[model samples]
Target: MLSYGKADVRNASHLALSNPLSKCAESTSSDLATSKLHTIIDALAFRARSIPDQTAFVHLVDGEVIEQAITYRELWSRSQSIAAYLKAFEPNGKRAVLLLDTGIEYVSWLFGLFHAGMTIIPAFPPIGSRGLSRLALICADAQPDIIVADARFSNARERLNDLLPSAMPQPYWVETTIPTGGPDCTGVGPARDDIALLQYTSGSTSTPKGVILTHANLVSNCENASLWMGDIRGRVGCTWLPPYHDMGLMGGILQPVYDGFSTLLINPGHFIQKPFRWLSAVSRYKVTVTIAPNFALDLCTDGISDAERSTLDLRHVRAIYCGAEPVRSRTIERFTDRFAAAGLDPATIGPCYGLAEATVLVAGKPVDKPFVSFHVDREMLSRGTIQVVDENAPGACPLVSSGRPAAGVEILIVDPLELQIVPEGRIGEIWVKGDNVGTGYWRNAVASSETFGGTLPEVDGQFLRTGDLGALLEGELIVTGRLKDLIIVSGRNLYPQDIELTVEETDSRIRPNGCVAVALDDGERERIAIVAEIKRSEKLDDVAQELLRRSLTAAIVAAYGVKPEHIHLATPGTIPRTTSGKVRRRAVRDALLAGNFAQYGGRTRAPVPADRSAS
Candidate 1:
């Protein structure tokens, strides 16, 4: 049995006691309290010893008033037991796929896998044949040694077996829900450099790639987040992001543990069905910190009713981090304005930027200040220059700041082709170098080298190419758009996100957040094509279609001084989206090229005036 004395437990509970103030307080010590610790296992062990009885996690089920809580002591004991059981299968140093539903149960298994020294591959539990097919592809690529799941999902073995190729080896199955007892082996875990997680990207633009994150990467990221956000040691955090995503896993689940904060977690489904439940939980639990993507903020702004807003008291919330997608300034403004009556502070809104390659957080706004944006000349922005102008200036576009880089992180805006640093206020690819950055992609050396091997002429080592276009103003970072999704028309650069947003804003008949803009090479100049989903309503005749198309075209021309070559209006859910709700622009483009939306009354490309130009 591993030794665990009373003194160790006492010391462990005090791990995060370095900061006694709330998140808003000015904390000079911007270092992770557990920076000296090598791996997350060490931190968890310390917590078990120090604050054994402190609630570690709370799960609020849909329609259930009573929330389930798990204390540190109980969590450690169960995880150790499960780890001991897993050791029988000799899973050490092997990748183990976790296909379980979200809850305290999944949390326990996650720690158990860590304790057993297994590389974890977190995947969503497959729901249907399509989901199973995706899982099968992941299984083929990962080639995991074992599959750990709830008893209810063990039957997935048969379905996966049928879908997988005959040559691949079948993985061992282990059900974590059942009670198991075995020899104690609590102290055994991975080293600092050992792989901790295989976080799969959402693949919005291409095939999914598994990002290899080490224990040190995770610990460093959590430390950087804590330091960047001030002292949130004892703050209550709430989240409904899926456990499989990087932001959800690192920022939501693991960060709280590293800081000794109690977290209230609701299922993503519940939050989608009723966004108010997320707010309600925060009010009831007095949650001080929370995080979500841009769409979730838009959803709550539009979905929550006046009566629902009246019940919410969000004054206790010190930070509401918005990330995982392009942060829209209008969404933040609308949400803050709409919720101010419920005591929501505009300062609490944090528009941050991050990706899986860097663990989770690269930069975030300080908790003490309100979110800010810069209004720049849109034409100059298209030409890679960020010229600050008055909001009412002609052709001005508001670009939200993604804050400064976290401690121990270095960011550079470099030309994508030449790999040379861009001038200040000039948009370019964002490259990051930090200890928190992951080693590389799993088993994919080409992508690993291409993305993680970026180097500058004056830099000593490789930097992570974020593939995101942004510019540095003064000291803050302003993300513009994705490099691959940049649309150049008549010598002017335009972001598809900007065009899609304009389309969504054009007509009430168009569904919110379901539009995609792509550029097609029409022999000479690039032509802009858009595929948008219309809200399901009374059938629209030819007249309605013509009016809708004209309104959309007029909106595009008004917002972006260029006419689109084609616009297609399809039924709801016709446009494809990644699992994390990011619009798959490339996939939509492919479908458009393949005539995949013919059943949804697809429209053909209309010739644009050759003399048209982006103002």
Candidate 2:
């Protein structure tokens, strides 16, 4: 059980601060900072010749059973053949949308598109007929010259045509899958500034925007992450994150190829269905590094049984990079404690911060290092400043550090209202400048300029406005909340995450990661509204719900000193999340205002109808 406690892991610098296997910072053989290679594909070509037989990727059929182990030469050759096939359509510098499932085909075709010098658009195929609108939106915006798919999705044209923008021409369709040991063909050599691919944001906040990453940007991010995380080669990494996302693409897929190493791949479905398979893979393949969202840590810690846990060894996992959501301090401590019997290192849980705009990693540390944290005066933290305090201090809230900036990356904490750099330990919007930062959104010049062209009056340089609220304490980045999601009551800035965490700890039936706290308009007054999901395993009766609602309201008041105007308890899976598994708090607020929760849950007393005056 996840217990909300006052204590947590602090600055445990006693843990190994360095990876002995690695060389000094930025000097590793695969370090692109000091290499002549401009693009990742260039590095791949070199490795393909020097170490042709090296294992590049291993695919898990069911997250544990190995389905295929693709070699460097095999992948290189496959990319070449696919590139040759693409050339028949004059694919040079044209957009090709890859709508494929998670497998070797996805990886092969991804590299193939780059080799063909075609601007790649990485997107997931629709599930049945669902999600076509979003795909159509992306496709319409991209105006792809060709659509590449696996053989199974050959009928995409019929379905996509109806959804595509009327003015755009129908994209040419190519349905082909590569076979092993295909005859090779020559591929194009791309320059550093050549457009490599476009990765669309998961759209947790608004419409999905494609972040344009060039050949240089992709290569730089790989090396920058490697510099911060220590050596990349001679170590096994694994990932079950959707391969198309920035984290999985750069960290899981491209990093190994850049360093001439092998990484295990698991279908996201497999990991979700059987969380134990992750630990099993770590034990079986001796995986040293892996990446996942914050929820996966709690899922694995609770989902794995003592009997099942005993059959595995996790000593090999050096770092489990946890990000893509608010990194809970309790989760890191709970996971480390639960697997202590199985040789899980306390330092293995590394909480990092990133976004699609920055090409995934903005700040991370050596995986071998422990995640640092600070217990601050909760009220001061909300008022755009930090006051470090003892854990036992009254009204103390613990915030986990998401490490420091990567090599060649500069982070500036700027006051959004003042338009100046805030003093350290003061909360502000996180602004970033680095090679890894994408150029701009695809074809959206206005949005691009606002996001990527920010500059301070005193400091001159291009900075990407991260739209995230965070502070720097002793040089470590402590992300507090989203700027747009900051909720204020009585002039106090209350982060929704803080309020939501308090609600989860209020009752045993409240699902972990199933609660969202938002501010709703109540006439001229703004009110705090909490929508939480009850676990399906628990019985939900009117009598039980009434008791639970009281507890939830009381808990919110006790924690935040503000009364929740309404508490609605819903069935499991009532809340919405993005494709990347981030809770859509904005969507939750929208649903609440739209009266969507009325159909899903039993609320406390007669619920207050949302005041549509603010809506």
Q: Write the per-residue lDDT of candidate 2 for residues 249-289, one digit (tens) a residue.
A: 88888877777767778899899999998887777666788
> Lowest-lDDT window of 10 residues in candidate 1?
18-27
Please write out the lDDT profile of model 1 over residues 1-615, one tens digit for every residue.
Answer: 322222222121242342112232121223336345887877777777766777777776542243556777877887888788877777679999988767787888899899889999988778777578778878888888999876778987898988888999999888765555687775567899999998888788888888999999988997788788776544778889989888988877888777777787788888988888888778766788998888888889988999989988889889999999988888888899999999998999998999999998998897788777999987888788999999999988788999888888999999998889989999999999999999998889999999999988777889999999999998899998899998888899999988888887777677767678988765587889887777776478778887887888898888778998777877777777777788888887777666565434545433333334221
Quick one: best lDDT, which candidate?
1
* C-alpha lDDT of all candidate models, in order: 0.80, 0.79
TM-score of each: 0.91, 0.92
Which pairs of residues collide in candidate 1? Answer: 9-49, 9-50, 12-46, 12-50, 13-50, 13-51
Please give the range of 10 consecutive residues that has the lowest summed lDDT in model 2. 1-10
Off by over 4 Å in 2: 1-35, 178-187, 598-608, 612-615
